[model samples]
Target: MGLLAAFTHTLEITLPVFLMVFLGLGLKRLGWIDAHFITTASMLVFKVTMPALLFLSIIQADLGRALQPDLIGYFIGYTAISFFLAWAWAIWRHPRVERGIFTQGAFRANNGIVGLALAAGQYGDYGLSVGGVLAGAVIVIYNVFSVFILSLYSDEVDTDFRSLIKNLARNPLILSVVFAIPVALSGIELSGWVMTSGGYLAGMSLPLGLICIGGTLSVTAFKRSSTIALDASLWKLVWVPLFGVLGALAAGIQGPALGIIFLYLGCPGAAASFVMAKAFKSNDKLAANIIVITTFASMFTLSFGLFVLKWLDLV
Candidate 1:
């Protein structure tokens, strides 16, 4: 596609996704939805709806094609490298209490929400299937690193290895992936009613997740921590995605796999980072600020990245 066409195509996919976010913000500001609603919706999306989406996507995908080792390996490697590098930088630049938050904000992507939405919007079910698998794999790695790093820096005595394992085992996304992959590989068809129910829940995941993201964004927190917020946002929204996509392309990742990787890299710092930070006694305010800033900034970066990818005929 030509540059102009690519831009239009990219906007066609991204604009509606962002409009939902803005609508969510406007609704929250207008008092139609409040903090309680945001929290409950977030929990619902995370625990129920997102897992349902992943289950449906994975179960419906051709595992032999969708489960690409190269793609999964690249994401895992890139994420590990990024996590350590960000941690090193965080330690060098920030105080101990804030290091975990900085590192988490810098490295974690909102892959399940923003990344999945972008992938599904641009490429539909095929894109979502590929992206769903990638999201499942990457999120497992992210949660592991998040728990380890947060516990490492945590002042709390209760943060233990058992808790880490427990948290990972209890992650709904992880569970969905684990359960669905075997069934997918086995070629077992879900019962009609089960598929119908799952599809219904899956349909609600993205919109609800995005709105929760918007509703949770705090303008006051952004103002309070503008410097750190901007720094983390730049790392998350611009630097990580740019380098990651270039590396993925260089490594021969192409087509929908490449698009999903690009979207994953370009996704904002997840809202869950804030929750994890608070749970582990990191700088939750800074984490929240990073989430807010990166979530907004990614609208531009992700669209531009998609435009470039399409212009090059990469996806």
Candidate 2:
């Protein structure tokens, strides 16, 4: 594809996904939704619909193709490296209390929400299948890393390993993937009614989650943005994805795999980071700012990155 064609192709994939976000923003501004709605809807998507979506996707996937050991391994290694790099930067530049928040903001991507949505947009069921399995690893790694980092800097936060493990054990998202894996591997078929019902609920997850994300975007947060927040946003939207995509190419990952990696890596800071920061008694406002800035900025960065990938026919 030529430059213009590549970009247009990219937009065709990305625009619908992002427009839901804008719709939510517009709805929120119009007094059609409030904080309570966002909070409740977020919880519903996180706990219920999203899990259903993941389970169905994984269970229906070609386990042999979807369970790419190399891709999963690369994601694990890349995430670990990125976490430590962000942590090291935070410790060097931020105060003791704020170090954890900054580090989390810098390295964590909204993979489960925005990233998965984009992946599905770009690659359809194949994307969701791969992205679903990948999300399982993401949930485990991000939670464990976030908990460890937050605990290191906060006396108020519990640092117990058992608690972390327990939380992860109960996470619906992780549990969904865990259960679906053996089923997919064993070729266990579910009833059509079950699949259909699950599909309806699953279908609601991404759009609802993206809308909540849009509603959660606060202009007030943008106004409160600090240098630290901007720095973290840069890392989230630019540096992390840049290094990650390069590493994937170096490893000979191409086509949809490389594209999926880029989309997930290029996602904005996780909304969970803000909650974790608050729980840890760190700079939550700064965390919020980073989320706002990165989320808004990613509209352009993700498009350009994907366009380049398409232009080069790498994905």
lDDT of 1: 0.86
**Candidate 1 residue-wise lDDT, 49-135, digit = tens:** 999998888888877777889988999899888889889988787778777888889999988898899888987877777788888
**Candidates' C-alpha lDDT:** 0.86, 0.92
The top-ranked prediction according to lDDT is 2
How badly does each model clash, as a count of residue pairs? 0, 0
RMSD of 1: 1.5
Q: How many backbone clashes does candidate 2 have?
A: 0
Q: What are the runs in model 2 whose C-alpha is more than 4 Å off?
A: none
Q: Per-residue lDDT tens digits of candidate 2, residues 1-315?
A: 799899899999889888999999999999999999999999999999999999999988888879999999999899999999999998888787778888899999999989999999999889999999998888889999998998888888778899889999999999999999998888888999999999999999999999999999999989888988988889898999999999999999999999999999999889999898888887788889999999999999999999999999999
CA RMSD for every model?
1.5, 1.0
What's the TM for model 1? 0.95
